[model samples]
Target: MALEWLVINAGLSLPEGFLAYLPSLDYLHDVQASASSLSAYISPAVKASLFILGVVASLINASVIPSSLGGPGNAVLEVQAHRGGLGHRTENSLWAFAHAMEMGVSILEMDTVFTKDGVPVVWHDHDISPEKCRGDFVGAYIANLTLAEVKSLSCDGQLAEHPQAKIYQDARIPTLEEVLDLIECYDNKMVTINLETKLDPLAPNETLPVEKYIDDIVPLLERRGFASRTTIQSFDWRTLIGIKKKFPKTVIVALVELETLMSINGEYPWLGGLNLADFNDNWIAAAASIGAEIVSPGHGFPWTDTIHTPGYEPFVNEDMVKRAHEYNMRIIPWTADDEATIAKLIDDGVDGIMSNYPQRVMWVGREKNRYVPRVGTKHRPHCLVNA
Candidate 1:
């Protein structure tokens, strides 16, 4: 009977040496099966071996299997709501930014273009586009328009086409001060504010006096007690340098847009004739020389080889990231909302990502166990999402 039990336990086969132990295991089972048949031949050593095997199996099942099922721990990914969560509402409107706060991203990224009245308003493009602004205001220029006039134009043009943004229709173009109010009202410090300086790129005459504009905006942020949490960024190195010199303690980031630079009146031939290749060596160096700590370029510059130039390979590469890091500057890529593209950027070790959909980036960070959650979402004014 002991031999039979051992053979069954061993799946009817055993090594030659283990075959000798089979008789012993079978005897122990037989003795245990019936108290009346218990025998002194059953050794405590065999009982201990069986107990140890059970313990080992339990440990393996708990540690190995659960770990395999759970996969990797959560990773932290810097999630900057591009134009304040373009996913939920119209991009850059006060309502949209408020919505982003509700989504609980690590950063609130918004563009600042001076109104004709010299007011620095939060907006992305230098001029309003047909895609975002519908009706008579579709192609109107932003720089030439006053804050009141710009406010009158609705950015929720896509609302009819995309119902998710229905609440965005009445959204107004919020002033820099208004954004600060939202931040302060929530008492949210985990969230950082990234303000993009959208200066005149096409209409050279529309440019604002650099120092004066900087003074106006910086003071407002300081007055609101956001100087420490606020980060000023611009594609124009001069603006960044000016802002840095005036507010030396404030965090400053340099923004780079590849397509805009390549455009006729954009940053490249229009602003400085420098492309992605010359950015790190020349453009980025200039900002770094002025003590700029963060550099945000288009994500395509670091990952893709497909140049917008037909039949031409992309000039941007991983070398750009290495060079930026060596300078002790953080690299935060811009405007990538797709999960796959964002994952690639995070994997490439970017300091942060500027995405329209901050939620996706936030989840990516939470999944990787490395995220720092920001302030209240536009959905909930009092809660924060932490990773």
Candidate 2:
């Protein structure tokens, strides 16, 4: 009887009524026959029908099966080298960018701070942290400090303890121009760049005006033909908006966090900012409202309160990725370093990720058959030998 059902579904050569009494059938041996006998019994029309059915089913499976359903190979994890492959070399150095290229990352992520002379330099923080730099205050802003004065301070800091800290030896700060040049040298491979504009409009004594900074960077990108390869990102929504207004062709990514937005209603109006909720409960909507092409949120946002906080549910969930996709936005979470967490993000359907160690992203890519972009091509101080 079971054989009858198989024959029906398999479109095999059999009596049309053979499956009608399948529920009551007892002995399976009744249908058993030699292969030659069965082949002789199959009519040419039935054989053709069965073959056609198999082909139709195959096409249906191929068309209906989600491209992402077939194991990890279908997943595309775009690797953005945060701080220019910080795991390989010093953060934001030319060496780091070059190394990222060699590793074949999807994007090169770096921070930018303007010099006093309105020159955009590739450095991570406005005020160097005690962790990355062991030094006195260089001044309030990068725009206030000359490139020479900025270079005098040690860019390397205690990334690890003692012997493990050998990576922090001779890493020097790199200018934004130098970083852009390095990226161009790679012939603009698989890598796109996410340039964070660290300029705070609320801060006092702005060294580089918004318009001036735009003027300085846009032409350089146009000349290098990297205007399309570049993405302007900023926590400051206004800056992103400005970039959009100025360069409609270039991609602009709006960066948001739960912290600063919550503080916007505070005593100092300047410190207060736009909350994510204000944009219709969707960060993508907010970005789109300002003509942004991409939406870049931190890892575990609105899910994990602290960076180390465990039990991230929605932040790394499929639902979040689906929602972002529904909005026609790509989910590229920032600075997620853990390998397991990164894999989870890929499985959750994120479009890409920003990682300090692009190598880990590349390893996952190789295992999953995803392509990682290559970067890092410039001279750097001794500490960046690995970079």
Candidate 3:
């Protein structure tokens, strides 16, 4: 029966009468003398060989079978390298992105702020911090500097205090165009770019106007053929709304910091003037209403006290995950680096994880047998050399 099942389901043909040498069932007996006679008909060596073959066949079948055939419930969770593995390399630098691609992360997560001349550049903060960059314009905002001026700053000194700071050498800030060009030219494997549009509401006038910001980026994405491969993420739902209206084919991710949702006055700047109370404080539904394909909430630890309200404890619980999945929306918690917290989030049934150390997420996924390899790349173990 096992051989027949394999032939039918596994598309393998077997020799006719392969079991013809075996004794008929009617002649079989449980008695020791009958058993001894049975061994004579089928030699011990042949019996052992058949057993090994059956094991091999079963393994092959398991690999090819679909999830419906008693396989895992969900596909492998996506591993997004936040700011191109900021834990290991200088954040948002081309060098960091290259190392992340080499490690075969499913997504290269980055943030973008426009330069003074309206050119989109890959940078995390609106203002250049002395901690991350060194130049005459160390404390100046990217919006006030041209792309050339921004590129002159060195990112290598940003990680001077890091244990692996020596690895950071001569790295400069890269423009969004340059990053896309590198991905197109060098990376052979499939990877998603989760690019966040950085907008500051507190000082809105200092950043690019919303209309111009979208205008500048959409064309670049279309020209580079990245609209399909990239997901535009933002804390500001207005930007997500704009993208949905203009580039309907592009994917959007709604980033939510739970503390930002604790507003009782309905004035959460991050929500783009949309009140959480209007959505019953359900961020998942709110994100879905704006055509967001994914909802990314921060991991509720370390920053919880800083972001969370005194009494509110909004979190990415199992119920929230179920709600998002029901809407065909994916839930990916952002910026989790520790194993224990990551394990908890996985237990809550997140669809993916965004982390500064994506290799850690990949490792946890492998431990659970849920790690999915990149489409065009062979399975490579998580890069742990730096860790």
Candidate 2's C-alpha lDDT? 0.60
How would you order the candidates by lDDT, starting with the best?
3, 1, 2
Best by lDDT: 3
Clashes of each: 18, 20, 0
Best by TM-score: 3
lDDT string, candidate 1, 163-251, tens digits: 56535454567788877777655544445788887765455555565565578878888887777677888776667667777878877
- CA lDDT scores, all candidates in order: 0.61, 0.60, 0.69
lDDT of each residue in 1-387, candidate 3, tens digit only? 232222322333333354333322111112122111223355556655665565465435322332112212255678898898888777887767777776667788999988889888898988888877778888898889998898788766646434552355656788888888767554332566899999866678667878866677877988887776788999877788887888888788999885556664548777766776788877787888888888888866443332333653436678888888887888888877777667777888888888878888977886775664321222223322121
Model 2 alpha-carbon drift over 4 Å, by segment:
1-75, 134-140, 160-168, 185-188, 201-207, 266-278, 301-316, 369-387
Residue 140 lDDT, candidate 2, scale 0-100: 47
Instruction: Specify the poorest-scoring 10-residue window by lDDT in model 1.
Output: 65-74
Q: Is candidate 2 or candidate 3 better by lDDT?
A: 3
Off by over 4 Å in 1: 1-76, 134-138, 159-167, 259-284, 301-318, 372-387
**Candidate 3 displacement at residue 185 in angstroms:** 2.2
